[model samples]
Target: MGTSFEKVHDYMGRRVRGLWQRNGKFYQQLLVEQPDGQVAPRRILLKSTTLDNCRIEMAQKRGIRDQGEAASEPLEIPSFAVCCRRYFDFHESLKHGLKRQTTIDRERWSLNRWQVHFGHLRVNQVTRVMINGFMQKRLRGGRNPRTVNIDLINLRQVLKYARDCGFFTDQERLPTEGVKPLRYKAPVRPLLKDEQFGLLCEKADSSANRSGPILADFIRFLGFSGGRYKESLRLKWKDVSFELRQVTFGSDGLSKNGKARVVDFNPALEAHLRIMHARRAPDCKYLFPSPQRGGKDIPASDLRGSLFAARAEADLEWVGFHDLRHFFASYCVMSGIDFKTIAEWLGHESGTALIDKVYGHLAADHKRRMAQKVSFSLAQQAASPAEQPAVAAVQQSPSAVLPLPTQSGESAATTALAS
Candidate 1:
């Protein structure tokens, strides 16, 4: 058959005239009549070869045109404030199971600052330049790089959620991806000295404050176990195995890494835990019961206040509760325990890189003691010069020594020896 042409009609009965195939190639043409009644033809080369394929292509084009027309009309996009609310709602939904209340609270706090600045704008209108401006404003307001980076991270999450929900067009880039976080150096928070720890504990025990003894025990427990503040505070009675000398950090996202970990108890921690366990009330489920809140886990705020008072009284104002954990890790490293072991004990899922970065510095006394252990010299010999091999060789060989080739292809014996 000669190259055939056909008219294709869409569902609306609008016919696309110039649907034809020649030499195994299909073509589509649209003829529009102008206001003056002159016809202008617009041609599109369709890659299909058969008449059926041409008809299908024509239908697809019509559907795409309809979609384009619909897209051209205005559609309401939610504002940044609305997206923030939705993000917070999503986070709140995940609370009590996948996420902790404290985590959600922090996210909300970080995103609130964003809402204050970008709330009026739609999610798609928050561009990278705007984010960069926000970062600059934060930095100008005396916020640290780490804090600003956290804010950016929170904003990024909200925007991503909006994009995924189809509030933003696919072509829009996330501001978070375009903005780079500022680089910052972590401050050095060293471990407390033995005498300092002793003084703090002594002061804590002697203080008239009701939380004094609790603070002392908590400090010592942290020093012994190297556990995080929340990890130790949330330690349940059932999670501790006194007979096995092991404590498990588990209670649905209790651990910082969101995975359960077992920490072996040393004799010190074991003895202290036993004492606490024995004194614990029958109705109390927490290992460290709150003195103020009866039966509940001790609030961190209480411990923090107690810790501050104890530190002041003991003249260890620089020592924080986290220092106790650092003290534990420092001792472990000085005792020749490998970083991998320390990381595992600290409930780190990743290996020793973090441990090495934070706890790599050894105390001066420990360094000096280590230095004394390294010796290069051997014991002095009682042999006389005549008994020494070098002396005997020089006396016996005098001028009859064989030349040994040197690395430079020269005779070693030819070079004069320094006296």
Candidate 2:
């Protein structure tokens, strides 16, 4: 066996800040030559305030051999497996501070699932046929088209990386180019006005269950305010300035979208919140605490559970916790809350496009209201004083009048003839 040694490669690519950053740092990768003669390259993620030190430290962590490691037996070409590992490592390395690890984890899971399916094959072996076949297999097994499309997206990224690394020369396009994603139509089952009021009353008065009342109030708060589930859970007592009657959101624990919105408290919701506030611990900060008693915010599972239980008690069906969001917008339209204000409450981008796309029908009633207004305006125009004077003038004129024949003249002619 040749002088056995581990080889390391430091990828001095882009420098960026991430979750674990003091200031800025360069990323590193390591490849080891096993005694079995298989060369394996691995990425060791590292970030430091100084890029220079990060490079040096990355090299040091590569292995003990410093001398001919770089030149000795140029590290064997990495396999598809190694390539994907590097791709994720690169992705994690460039992660921005605002990016949530949950999102990264979800993306990583999708990528790795694809890898497990086909990472063993050579990069060049991947063809559109192979991709379509895989998708067909997944779809035949009852996977939703949306899921298959997600897998396709993850594969596209992998193939792109392979092309970039010169594994294949097909610069023309990705294998997924011709693939069309499945269409998903959002279900349109908005709560009727009476149904919404009934649900709220049920939540407020559910005395049978320990968790029902708190969960009910929280749900009602969401229904009334159009706040996201996580936003509601993350709400702090400080966020609500009862004096100003304004509720501000927390900067640190804002939702995944990183948006904070305030809702002008309706008198009803404000009263309910005040009652909940009185029960809140002075030091225990969160407006909604986990029933288990030790967490920053209530677990999503609890919220889901409470929602299901309340729905059961209220005999309401087909409405999700998020449907409360739709309910809010729909009720807003019914109550005459303007779309712009409703969008702001829902944390939507300004403009009717997204709002209309998601809840266009919710605003249908508004369209009807507008139509009614137009009809009323036209009716008033037809009966206005200006038109009335013209009608009176026509009625007063003889040319516009019709005369009736006189029956008395006919009767007098008949009498004269008899005489």
Instruction: Provide the TM-score for each candidate, comma-separated.
Output: 0.69, 0.63
Per-model tally of clashing residue pairs? 0, 0
Name the regions of candidate 2 deviating beyond 4 angstroms: 1-81, 90-98, 157-172, 192-194, 200-204, 243-245, 264-271, 294-301, 335-341, 349-351, 369-419
Q: How high is the lDDT of residue 328 in model 2?
A: 75
Task: Put down candidate 2 lDDT per residue, 1-419, tens digits, no spaces.
Answer: 23322232235644322112322323345566533347665443464445557656555554434554442223233455667776666767874544466765776777776667676765566577877777788889998888878877767777777667656655556676787776756456756465665665576456465666567667777777777777677777778888988676545554656767778887866887888898776657777766666544443236676667666666676667687777777777777677677777777766556766666675676676555443334543566454444344443552453223376553332333234
Native-vs-model 2 lDDT?
0.63
Model 1 scores worst on lDDT over the 10 consecutive residues at 376-385
C-alpha lDDT of residue 151 in model 2: 75
**lDDT per residue (tens digit) for residues 328-364 in model 1:** 9899888878889888888767679888777676644
> lDDT of each structure?
0.74, 0.63
Question: Highest TM-score among the candidates is held by which one?
Answer: 1
What value does the lDDT take at residue 418 in candidate 1?
20
Task: Give the RMSD in angstroms, all C-alphas superposed, for model 1.
Answer: 13.9
- Stretches of candidate 1 off by over 4 Å are 1-75, 95-97, 278-283, 293-301, 363-368, 374-419
